[model samples]
Target: MFKHLLPRMRERSAAANRPVSLSDMMEEFWREPFGNLSPLFRDAGYPAVDVSEADGVVTVKAELPGLDPKDVTISVENDALILRGEKRFEDEQKKDDYHRIERAYGSFSRVVPLPGKVKEAEAKARFEKGVLTVTLPRDAAEAVRNIPIEGA
Candidate 1:
């Protein structure tokens, strides 16, 4: 029944030096159906992100554990902040037997819409302790204006 996913599951089993069981294949079949439905879902595979604006500056933070700063790329395009990174699979040369592997290893991209106009040229990013913080100074000249309503 899980023929389509057998090869992929076999590779994972081989990587862990374990045999793939029928139950394991069934579990993977159920889990793969919800892939990338929405960023609102916690299992969407995208890193956790927080965005806030204060004092004409917009700050964005993303959690990226087990990733080097160089592996991540940040950019601003179409008034959105784009975060891209890859977490490579670690291959160990030890003789220890594996039990469970839950960490995700692959490339992920996240697009966050900016709250307002920002100076993309002056944007700054810093990575500290597996967290990436990006600061973007908002453009005051292009700030939104509230027009008074004359009549309905």
Candidate 2:
């Protein structure tokens, strides 16, 4: 029954560098019931992250809707910033029947490479409106500067 979907998905996967995880496929299945409907974005095992390094600081922003700050963890590992979290889907009313569940929910872990060395202990993190922002101070000693040389 799903023969066409497999090949199409495979072709897409081959075209894109990032491999779609199983959770993403499951979410796609649950949300996209009809073939004609537009397929929702799938971010499996990782959230959409934007990382920028400028003015002696590194800033990372991640989109994690419907997730609490307490459930998230930020860490610096091997010169990379790591973000891990889980968005739990609660059944507030057991009597309610869901017609369409388009929101993707689950645990995710992602790593962003730093542009330069950062002061790990001085990092600041903030979560507001289901978005996570992490600010890291860059190490001054790691900054590159040209050294003057005398001709012999």
Candidate 3:
């Protein structure tokens, strides 16, 4: 039966460390965003994000439409860039005035692990035209830090 195959598919995906499927990816996009998964799933939610590093600077750009700049918060924790925000959908002033509102409303958090250390205090973030961009300059003294292998 199809029900039996669904669970088996999930088990295989977990074992292989790969995304379930394109159809399954769409399902996950509707259900919950994949913050725990790889960055390939960055475009899975209401506001998708794009991250890149260049010239000793790491930039993170997120699509946040219909949101005020003050409604969002950006912070750094343990060398990781954290973006947190909420979006709300309000239809009409009176409930009886409108039929319904199918817009999605909720809070989202994105934690991006930096490739190298960043100066949190010196970082700059700007929200222009619904796009949130955070620019982080790499640490000067320690431009490149070696990540240690565990149980290798």
Candidate 4:
């Protein structure tokens, strides 16, 4: 009796593993039946981040869609860099206008620890096209030192 549905189920299972489509599948996998699932449908608040270090600086890039510069905050202390922001859902829908909605909205925070100390006063942050880029200049003196070694 369930033989006909096997192929369709298999197709969906296969699609869930595709790199680009895996996120959607994961979201759907957690959805509950016949309940208020608005929160679940909202965007995964955490943004994707990338970090790179060169010479005496570390660069971090975070993807924050539909966010204003003032809404985001970046800070570093004791070798730790933190990113925090809130995503608000301001859209209002009429009783008979919408069928399905899937966009995350809420407060999100991400903290990253740097491998070395940075010059707090020299840190820089920029926001463009929904991406936040932060550049932290390392303390040059703290990054290197000559230790005298006596032959044993």
RMSD per model, one decimal: 11.8, 9.8, 8.4, 10.3
Instruction: Flag clash pairs in model 1.
Output: none
Kindly report which residue stretches of model 3 are placed more than 4 angstroms away from their true locations once superposed.
Answer: 1-46, 93-102, 145-152
Q: What overall lDDT goes with each candidate model? A: 0.86, 0.82, 0.81, 0.79
TM-score of each: 0.68, 0.65, 0.62, 0.62
On TM-score, the leading prediction is: 1
Better of 1 and 3 by lDDT: 1
**Model 1, CA-based lDDT:** 0.86
lDDT of 1 at 6: 74
Candidate 3 lDDT at 22 equals 65
Residues forming the 10-long window of minimal summed lDDT in candidate 4: 18-27
> Sort by lDDT, best first: what order?
1, 2, 3, 4
Off by over 4 Å in 4: 1-45, 92-96, 145-152
lDDT of 4 at 119: 93
* Per-residue alpha-carbon lDDT of candidate 3 for residues 1-152, written as tens digits (9 for 90 to 100): 57768777777777878767665566667786666577766556546777798998989898988899888989999988888888876555655665676666789887887877888888999999999999999888877669998995
Candidate 1 residue spans exceeding 4 A from truth:
1-45, 149-152
Clashes of each: 0, 0, 0, 4
Give Cα distance to truth, residue 88, candidate 3, Å: 1.6
Expressed as tens digits, the lDDT of each residue in 85-129 for candidate 1 is: 899987785776779779888999999889988999999999999
